[model samples]
Target: MRIVSGGIQHETNTFSHQPTTLADFERDSGCGPDFSGGQAVFDRYRNTGTIHGGYIDAADVLEFDLIPLICAKAQPSGVVESTAFDTILNLFLDRLSETPAVDGVLLDLHGAMVTAACDDGEAPFMEAVRERVGPDIPIIATLDLHANITQRMADACDVIIGFDTYPHVDMRARGREAGELLVRMIRGEVQPVQAYRQLPLLTMPPMQCTLREPMQSLMQNVFRMEDEPGVLTATVAMGFPFADISAAGVSCLVTTNNDAALAEKKVEELAGWLWDLRDELQPQLTPIDEMIEFAATHDGPIVYADGSDNPGGGAPCDGTVVLRALIEAKFQNAVVGILHDPETAALAHQAGVGATIEARVGGKTDDRHGTPIELPAYVRALCDGHFVHHGPMNQGVVGEFGPMALLLVGGVEVVVSSNRKQLLDREMLRVIGVTPEHRRLIVVKSAVHFRADFGECATHILDADTPGIHRPDYANYDYQNLRRPIYPLDNVTVDFGG
Candidate 1:
């Protein structure tokens, strides 16, 4: 029996000003032999020798012939450029063609991907791949817990599994599970039947952590289904809201066999349960000014999230709202990483460290959020912005910071980079000479995932209401594509499926 594996991941933020390009992917993460399986894909399943890592280690145990395809994952940001999309997708497809036919295919895809030209990008790719493989061959996929599962993707693949936990500790376990499930399909042990239900509500990532009550209850139900005989696996994806698509909200999926109808019924029941409890999902968020004030009063090692400007969710990481707030609040001992000013980074690299340089930073990409602030600053540290990740998501991962500089403007230390990516791990700080361990206050342009690293030793880890395309509120944006009258968007009642 043979099995094929590949992945393509991108979280599209409909409101980001910059177009996601090949250069962005290259500088942040070096484009190399394993394309589709980069930081998120490879790290999840990367195994050293122990029974551990994150997700990839478990895949090693399952022992499928790994055809590590070209995986192109950029920070969740604006619509993908057509050229960039074609390049990555075609490379992955070409690899699939050359790698030999197989019994099953494993894909790691971000459900909320949108291209500059096309709203539904995952469909065409899945349809194209399905057309080549034929129907009998099973396809099982793992998605971001926050994936916006589209109808096209649901129709093409036999199974779609999402991270049960929002903190997403199961990256390796899920991959191994998918492999085990695929092997079963090859051996004729289980023929999978699937069910999917879309919910009407859409909210931000900060409010969507599965560790909490609403999502926690939802995740527990998914686990309980595994104990049932006919059910092979159960997954509930909250769905990424930033991407403007027809299927942009929450959804629950069930992959089972004996009774497809029963499975679909179960999914519907769960979706309805979640829909009824939609108000509970809204986050108890902190104010941006309060976050700054706390950092000022606190002693050392605090991490504040400018969540609205998180590039991972497709917001222009360069938004100046929170930064401006910090400046206005007169907070000191605060260090900000990744303003994502490429021009400013270039000049700093040219001038070298210890060189005093004055430039405009932040709010450059999207003034809809805030205007740029010019700072007469000194380059405290200069780095190529390169580091091998030592974190859960991208362990053993090598990537460049690509012309990064640590700029000191009065009390604020601005970490600027040519790459538009989130500060997930300490390497983003350590690699740039700004020691992650030493700082009193660390501000990163990321959402929940930053907690994995910063959560430890952090006197306080909090969030800010900085402006960008990926605001937590669902009503702020004009979404023409999403199915009309869904959940929190309209507050209407409708039947949901599992």
Candidate 2:
């Protein structure tokens, strides 16, 4: 059987000012450059730890012909440009039209994508594909755990599987599952029936981590349900709350072998269970000042999560709240990573290693993430910003931060980079000659993904309540489009019995 597979994956943040352009997709970073179309998808993703890699691996084992198409992705940013979205979609569809015959399609998508013209971006993309493939063809998709699933997406695809883990280590596994299920459907082994339920609740990134409590137990329950008779697959998407769209909240999806009743029952059961654990999922962050004091008093190698300014969630990744706090409090043996400031990084490169130079770093994107702090810093090290991830998430994938520099300002060491990226690996720090394991305090500009790499050695971990776009405090955001009566945003009653 010939199966066509490819996707445009992006997690849009509606609150971000930076618009995602086609150039952004084309630019190469640590995640790799974007492919316009065809065999390049197979060439770039094969043997990697990505969804496309999983599809290729499954194709080899399952002995099915897999036709490659356009697969492009950009760093998580603002709403995708209409031109960029249309161009990529048309490219994929045109390739599909060229294929002689297709039995099924597997899409690797991040369900939170929002375009300039569409709030539910993945739905429209899937609909256009459906228009080309007709009703008989089975389309399966693998999504991030933070997908803001909509009814349009549910109706457009046969099966939608989301990652069971938050740091999203399960990408390949989920992709393999989608491929396996598609193979089953193609062979008439299973008739997939899907059920979807969107919750009125939104979860913060810090609490949505599957490695921690509440989420860990919740995912365990999802796996248990998936093993039940008649159930083909199940997903518990915590949802990307950073996207200020109507569907920006928690959702549950269940698929069974042509068992609609069973699917619906499972979805409702999981949704109700999640609703009952709402309070636990709602995160409480410590104030930056208090957190610093706590860290100073605590043991070495503490990791302070700078979530509000997470570039992964579309923040600028140049927030200075934590860095400023660390400097002002005279904290010793501290390090702050991935401050996305090209000007400062360039200045460091010009100054060369072991040179002392006066430079202003971070807070360059906007006023929301603290002002740029001016300091006479010593440029300790510089790098080309290429390193492979050694963490559980995205392991073996090379990351690039463009030109990077390590600067020492007082007792604090800062890692400045030209490209905006979340601090998800210890390799990001080590690439700049600063070992994270040796630091007394390490500040990562990430929401939760850093936990996969940094959590193990951390003496204590705390989420800083910094002011930025991705802050866990829902009230701080001026959300105009999101459906009202959502939890924390409004105190609404929930009837789980129904």
Candidate 3:
């Protein structure tokens, strides 16, 4: 059987000031740059541990011809520009038109994507593809765990699967599952029936982590349900709360073998279970000062997660709230980083390693994060910012932070970077000669993804409440378009029976 495979992935934060453009997709980082046609996609993702990599492996094992098309992915950012969205979509469609007849289609999509013209971007793309391929062909798509799944997206595709892990180390595994499922369907072995249900709850990133309690137990239940008779797959997307779209909330999906009733029942069951655990999914963040004080009382190597200013969720990453607080509290032997500040990084690079320079660093994006603080910093180290991920998530993939520098600002060592990326791995600091294990405290500008790497060595892990666009204070955002009566934002009751 032949299958057409391609993807367009982006997790848009409508509150972010940075607009996602075509250049952002072409830039190297995250899942790498944009690739057009099968050869390019195959070349870049063949040996990688990405969704496409998983698809390629499955194709090799299943012995099916995988026709790859455009595969474009960008780091989480603001609303995608309409032009950029249309350009990538047109490329995928144009390539699809030129390809030969295929048994089925597999898509790698971020279900939370929002563009200027479309709030549910994946729906339009799926609808267009469905129109071209007609309704008979099987279409299966994979989504991020934070996908804000909608009815339109559900109706447009045959099957939808989302990541079960928060750090998202299961991309390859999910891709293989989708590929294997598609192969089975094409061979007339199973007929797929899917059910989608959206919940009124919006969860914070810290609480949504699969490594933690409620999500961990929830994912275990999903796995158990997947093994049940007739059930093909089950997914629970916690939803990207950073996006201010109407469908920006949690969702549950279930796919069964020609059993629509079973799918509906399973989805409703999962949703109800999640709703019951809503209180557990709300994280209690420690204030920056309290976290610092708490860390001081504890042992060395505490990990402070600055979840509010995480660049992974599309925040600027230049927030100085935690850093400033740490400095003010005279917190010694602390290393905070993966701070996105191009000007400061450039200054450090110019001063050269070991050279002391007076500069204002971080909080440059806006006042929401915090005001930039001026300090006399010694440039401890510098690098080109290239390192392989030594963590569970994207283990084999290489990451780039553009030019980076290790700055000793007072008692803290800060790793500043020109490019914005969450500190998901220790290699991000190690590349700049900062060892995390030896430090008294290490602050990562990330929500939960950092846990995949830094959680083990940390004596204590605290989610610090700071100020930024991606802050967990959901009530602070002026959400103009989200559906009414959502949980946390508003008190609401869910009727699972309906």
Candidate 4:
């Protein structure tokens, strides 16, 4: 059987001021081993700085004729540039058309992309692909746990699987499930049916994690439903709240063959369950001052989610909201990563390790998020940050935190680097010679993904409304063209497909 697979991934934040440009994608995400490398590198591309990966190791395991098109995505941005989307789409199609008659299609998609000219970006792309492939062939897709699923997406694809974990440790596993489901459908072993729903409420805070309270229980029930006879898979897409598109809301999806109706019913039940507990899914947000006070009193390390500047969710990752707050409150024994400063990093490196230097770090690009934080810090260590992901998301993948240094700033040891890196794992800290466990408070510039690695060790975890590009509040977005009459945007109630 002939199979064609590729990916176009982006999660747009309509609220962001930056446009999703080709250059952004090229610099932040692109590098298929096909591009010319005169380029300044995404030094921390994977975990070890290697790019050209999209299939997530499932490709090698399945071992079919595979064509990997450019799958580049930056953190949430403003609307995607039309030129960028068209060029990538054309390349992907050109590649697809060259291949022989295909048996199946798989896509690595971020379900929250929006274009400057259009909203619901995934629908138009899928419709184009559907037009190309026709109805008989099956299309399977895997989404980020933060995917904002639309009805058009559900209608177009035969089976859509989403990441079960927020830190995206289950990314490859979901790909595996999609690939296996494709084989089953192609073999006529199982027919796929889907059920979906959008809740009235929108967004469960930036750090809403599947391993915690309501989301954890929700994921457990999703598994239980899958174990039932005739249920192929079940998913709980918490939805990307930053994308002001109409599809932004919590959703439940179920796919199966033998009992399609039963699958729909099961999904509806789960959707209702999620809706009932919508308000409860949120992490208890602690104000920075209160969080510090609490941390000072705690015996073990406390994990703080700097929800404002998460690079994984399309944030600048350089906002000094928490840093400023920490400095003001005179908080100590805290490790906050990272302030993306190429200049400051260079200065620190030149200053040599153990030298004291004053550097202006963080809050350079977008000051609306937070004030600039300057501190006299001692350069502790510098390294070409390298580590293999020991987690499920990109396990064994090498990454680099280029020209990185540990800066001891006002009793808070900070991880500063030239490149923007997601602090999803503990090693991100450990690579810079800082042990997060040894600190009283560990502030991570991440959304929900950090919970995967740090949740186990944290005595208490709190998400703060720190400032950045990706705000959790949906109404704060300045939407010009997103479909109206949707949740939070227009306050419309949606019924589960009953």
Candidate 5:
């Protein structure tokens, strides 16, 4: 049997001022810079731990011909430019139309993508694919745990499998599951019936982590439900709340073997179980001052997750609130990593290693995060900022932050980069001569993904309540398009009838 597969992935933050463009996708896809279409897709993902990697493995095991097409992804940022969105969509559709007698399609999607043209990006993209493939073709998609699932997306695809783990360690696993299920459907071994529901509740990244409570119990239940007789699969997309779309909230989906009743029942049960814990889903954060004070008195090896300025969630990684406070307090042997400051990084590279250079670092994006820090920084090291992730999440994937410079600003060692990236891996610091394990305090500009790598050695992990677009505080966001009566945003309950 023959199958065609590819997708465009991005997690858009409406609150961010920088609009994502096609140029960003060319440079920052999971497959590396300027990668798209055909054999390049297989070459990049064949042995990797990404969604497409799982697809490749499934193709080898299931013995189905997997035809790869255009799969492009840009860093999480503001809404995509309309021209870029249309260009990629048309390219994907055109390729699908050109394919010969394809039996199925597998999409590797992030599911939280928002463009200038549409708030519900995945729905329309799937609908377009459906239009090209006709009704008989089976389409299965693998999504991030944080998908803002829409009913239209459910209607367009045959099966939707989402990651059960945050830090998203299960990308390849979920992809393999989707592929195996698709093969079953193609062989008439199992007929898939799906049930889906959108919750009237939204949540933040810190609490949505499957490694932590509420989510851990919730995902365990989802797994148990999947083990039941005739249940094909189950997904609990915590949803990307940073999106200002109407579908920006928690959602549940269940697929059963030709059993719509069972699918609906399992989905309802999942949604209700999640809804019951709405109050517990809220995140607790440490004030920057309190975190700094604790670091002063405490021993070594503490990790402060700077989630508010997570570049992965579309916040500019240059937030200076925590860095500025640490500098003023003279925090020593501490490392703050992967700060997005191209100008400062360039200056450090030009000044050479061991040279003390006057550099203005971070907080250059906007006023909401914080003001830029002006200080005399010693250029300790310089690197090309290319590294492979050895962590549980996105392991074997290539990551680039352009050129990077390690600057010693007062007692704090700051790693600045030309590109914006979340500090999720230890290799991100290690490449620039800063060892994370040896540092007294390590601040990562990430929400939860960092835990997959950094949590293993760190003595303590604290979530810092800083200022930026991705902050867990719901009040920081001004929601003009979101559907109201959601949890925390309002005191409301949901009764999604099975």
Candidate 6:
């Protein structure tokens, strides 16, 4: 069987000030700067643990022809520019039109994406694809765990599987599942029927983590449910609260083999189960200043996660609150990194490795994250800022931070870079000449993804309540377009029809 595969993956944070553009996709897609459409998609994801990587594995194992199209994935940022979205959609549609007859289509989509022209980005992309391919051809998609599920998105695809794990280690698993299901549909093995439910709830990233309580056990139940008779697949999208859209909330979907009643029953059960845990799903955040006291008395290898300024959630990685607090408390043998400060990094690079340069670092994006820290920084090391992920999530994927410099500021090692990237893998620090295991205290500009790599070895991990758009508390954001009567934001109760 022949299958066309590709996607435009982006998680848009409507609260973020930085607008995603075509140039951003070209530079950061992991497909390299001059991203060739066909072979480049296969090359970039063939050996990795990504959605596309999973699709490639399924294609290889199933002995099916997987035709590659354009897979454009930009870093998580604000709403995509209208022109850029159109260009990408047109490219994908053109490729689909040019390809020979295909039995099915596989998509790697970030369900939370928003474009300047539309609140629901994936719906338009899928609708466009459906229009091109016609309804008979099956389309299966894999979405991030944080997708803001919509009725339109559900209507466009035969099956939409979301990652079951937070820190999102299940991209490949879900991808493979989507591919396998699409093949089943094409072969007439299983006629998939789906049921979707959008809950009256909005959840922050910290509590949405599948590794933690409520979600941890909840996802386990989801896995158990998937094993039930006649069930094809199930997904629980915790939803991305950062995207200020009408459909920015938690949801559940279930697909069964020619069993619409079974699908509806399973979907409602999943939604009701999630809604019951609403109170427990609210984020529990510890202020950075409070964490400093605990770190002072504690032993080495404590990880402080500043979720507020996480670039993964579209917050500027340049937040100085955590760094400033560490400096004020005179914490030694601590490492604060991968901070986004192009000016500081560039100066450090120019000054060379032993030179001490006076510069201001971080907080450059906005006032909400905190002001810049001006200090004399001793340049410890410099690098080109390119490394592969050495972690469970997105393993083997190439990551770049542009020009980077390891600066010793106030006896603390600060790894600053010209570009913004969330601190997820330990290799991000190791590449810049800092060993993560030996550090006394490690400050990371990330939410939960870092836990996938650092959580195993660290003595303690605390989520710091700093100031930024990606902060754990959803109430901090001023919602202009979000649908009302959601949990935490409002006290509207839900009845699941038990």
CA lDDT of every candidate: 0.73, 0.88, 0.88, 0.73, 0.90, 0.89
Candidate 5, residue 218: how far the Cα is off, in Å: 1.2
Task: Highest lDDT: give the candidate number.
Answer: 5
Model 4 stretches astray by more than 4 angstroms: 33-63, 258-260, 473-498
The CA-based lDDT of model 1 is what? 0.73
297-410 per-residue lDDT for model 2 (tens digits): 888799989899998998999989889888898888999988999999999999899999899988888899999998899999999988887887877776778899999988
lDDT of 6 at 436: 89
State each model's C-alpha RMSD to the native: 3.3, 1.5, 1.5, 3.8, 1.3, 1.0
TM-score of 4: 0.89
**Candidate 3's residue-wise lDDT over 343-366, tens digit each?**
999999998998999979898888
What is the lDDT, from 0 to 100, of the residue 39 in candidate 1?
49
Model 5 CA deviation exceeding 4 Å by range: 30-35, 496-498
Worst 10 residues of 2 by lDDT: 28-37
Better of 5 and 6 by lDDT: 5
Error of 4 at 415 (Å): 1.6
Model 1 lDDT per residue over 80-142, tens place: 898887877787778777777666777767677888777877777787779878888888877
Among all windows of 10 consecutive residues in model 5, the one with the lowest summed lDDT is 28-37
Q: lDDT (0-100) at residue 202 of candidate 3? A: 91
Pairs that collide, model 6: none
Ranking the candidates on TM-score from highest down gives 6, 5, 2, 3, 1, 4
Please estimate how well model 6 matches the true structure, expressed as its whole-model Cα lDDT: 0.89
TM-score, every prediction: 0.90, 0.97, 0.97, 0.89, 0.98, 0.98
